[model samples]
Target chain A: MTYCVGLFLDDGLVMLADTRTNAGVDNISSFAKLQVFSTPGDRMIATMTAGSLAVSQAVMNLIQEGVQDPETGETATIYTVPSMFRAASLVGEAVRQVYRTHGKAMQEHGLSFDVSILLGGQLHGRTVRLFQIYSAGNFIEATGDTPFLQIGEHKYGKPILDRAVTSETNLIDGIKLALISMDSTLRSNLSVGLPMDLLVYRKDHLEGPSLRRITEDDEYFLMLRKRWSEAISEAHRQIPQPDWGF
Target chain B: MTYCVGLFLDDGLVMLADTRTNAGVDNISSFAKLQVFSTPGDRMIATMTAGSLAVSQAVMNLIQEGVQDPETGETATIYTVPSMFRAASLVGEAVRQVYRTHGKAMQEHGLSFDVSILLGGQLHGRTVRLFQIYSAGNFIEATGDTPFLQIGEHKYGKPILDRAVTSETNLIDGIKLALISMDSTLRSNLSVGLPMDLLVYRKDHLEGPSLRRITEDDEYFLMLRKRWSEAISEAHRQIPQPDWGF
Candidate 1:
């Protein structure tokens, strides 16, 4: 299982994903799940995927290779898409194409062709957008009322996002909340492990200095995890105890 | 869906369960999921269930009616059980019987005959035990190393237990942590709602004065919910921020 979260705030987008992948309990491994596509000053796109590693890799490859735009008769890739929505559509098409090519063989072996992607970014002149793309190649955009999207092992980390995130949140708070949420998931589930990938997209900056790979040695994350646990324990102690007789 | 947790401690047992039941989003209603049986100074057993309403109800009925023990050829029921183990066996046997009677018909209608129960308590001469009974009637006990068990919509509430619970935890602290865990589930899941039922069993006290039904008007719960949220936000503020330039 994987855990990926995308936050859409007024300032821009904050995306995070864990790198753990496993075929079974004994075959655990880590692989980068976050993908970045950017043509400086033109557009910047970030996608984090969860589900079948094969299918997600295939879709990413197809997107990188580009496809013919049905309307313009020209190949449209993540770089060349005129809008965030079209870039999302291009990703969706890539998914469908991969499914058409590999879905049947996977079913023959009783495996699912499951894959879900959190897509967030902007085109130079367009406003930033966030979308959750499903396995069927369809997608839904996040709205201000529900401005965050999560995929895979999501429930454990969701309450924090539900309570702390909002459209008006700045990129810094967004990243903090995302890390706290990820910390909660990592503590509860073995399927989701360490070595996380984080990216913060500033509103108008098309690129540079916005990505970090967090491993066991990352001092900030280590401190955040320790402090957050202490905070939760402190919070637990601060709650008023029920005055019941027995 | 339901959210129930059982904690086994050196001092006793603490069990908490939400009563909300739903066939779908529109068909939600409240039904008590926690059942308690006590034979004064002899023994006490509590069973909390999650899954198909019909299957659980039937299992409860069969346990109440009694069954012949295959090993001794004597009738066994929760009240007559010699130890906590036998009481759990009785509940497990009841589950198997209910499945034998209704499993196929439910499957024919494309529904699962699924039900899981958390049983916890003690007999006067025996140590306290907690068991999580599966749909097949097989069960696993909570040990000193892992002192808590949860069922149904469990993930959202698990991190707290993972971090805070242990065999040496006192009864009051156990109950507090259980409530905090349940509060987390209640906030994130619509399927698990208010009017929760909580039961605390002190070792060797076959007994009374330790159960309460919490409702929307419950003052302690309201305060805990408010304070916990604030504590989390405060903790968030106290964590060190990433020193990145973008």
Candidate 2:
């Protein structure tokens, strides 16, 4: 299991992903689920994956190596895609290719070919865009009405995002809200653990994104967790108790 | 679908259940999910149910009528159970009986025998207890360490309960927390809807519990929803944005 969230705001994009992967309770290991493809000023594409590790790795490898268009025999990769929409299509094609290769064998062994991806980034002349791609090679973009997309262990942390986040939010506050959402999921579910991979991409600033690896002892994260907990306690305390006269 | 929660605390018990039942998004209706059986000072028992309406209704009817024990050739119903634990077992037995009668036919029709129940209350001379009964006729109790149990669309409302409610929480505070939890689920899930049933029971009093059917126009609930949203926004505003120099 994994928890990855992406916020496409007015200022930029905030993407976060946990590193934990487990075959079972006893077979847990850490694997970075966020991948970044950059050609400096040309483009910067970030993808966060959740689901079968084998399938995700295969799809990522295919996208990185480039997929050929059957109609034109032309090869295109994430770094070379002309637009954000094309990049999303490239990722979706890579997923479909992987499914064609392994879907049947996996189903024969009683495994479902489950995978999902969050693709968000920008090209030099294109606008910053975010999308959530499904196992069927279909995808949906994040719009102004819904500026955030999440994959894996999503429900536990959703209410906070639903209540607090919007497209007009600032980049720094977007990061804060994403981390807070991640914190809720980490506390409630043991399957999603740290260290985490975070990327902050400023819209139209194609020089590359600011990236950080958040570990267990990160001071700012620890403070945020503590302060958020305290703030919630205080907030609830302020609400008058129901006067049902029970 | 339904959303129901039960809190077992030092002061007593707080139980809540939503009334929405839907076969699909287009077919939605309200049906009471909470049922109470009390003999004034003798005992007071409450049951909140979720899952297949047909299955839940059948089990409820079985418990209301009496289920006969094979070993002693004796009949026992929820109202006649000797202790709270026995009452839980009676509900579980009713569920199993329903399965025995309908499980095969439902499975043949590509339907599941799905149902879950939350039973909480006290007998005249016994201790107060809360049990979550499953479709298999198995159940688990809520302990002092983990004093609350939820069923049906539970994840969206879980974090607040995990952080706030405890065995030592006062009855009034317990009611407040439960309502807040319900509010979260209501906001996030369309399957769980309005006209909720709430019951509050005081330990050892057993003189019948305070029962309320909260309609959409309920004043306290409306105020709580508005205030809670404001409190959350204000709480998040106080947290410092990440200083990672992005």
Best by DockQ: 2
Per-residue C-alpha lDDT of model 1 across residues B133-235, encoded as one tens digit per residue = 9999899999999999999999989988888887998888888889889988988888899899999988878754289999989988888788887877777
Q: Among all windows of ten consecutive residues in candidate 1 chain B, which has the lowest summed lDDT?
A: B201-210
Clash pairs (backbone) in predicted model 2: none
Runs off by more than 4 Å, candidate 2:
none
Instruction: Give the backbone clash total of model 2.
Output: 0
The lowest-lDDT stretch of 10 consecutive residues in candidate 1 chain A is: A233-242
DockQ of 1: 0.75
Candidate 2, residues B1-246, lDDT tens digits: the string is: 789999999989999999999999999999989999899889999999999999999988988899986567789988788898888888888899999999999999999889999999999988899999999999999999999999989999898898888899888888888988999898888789999999999999888999999989999999988888888877777888777889
The model with the greatest lDDT is 2
Error of 2 at A31 (Å): 0.5
DockQ of 2: 0.77
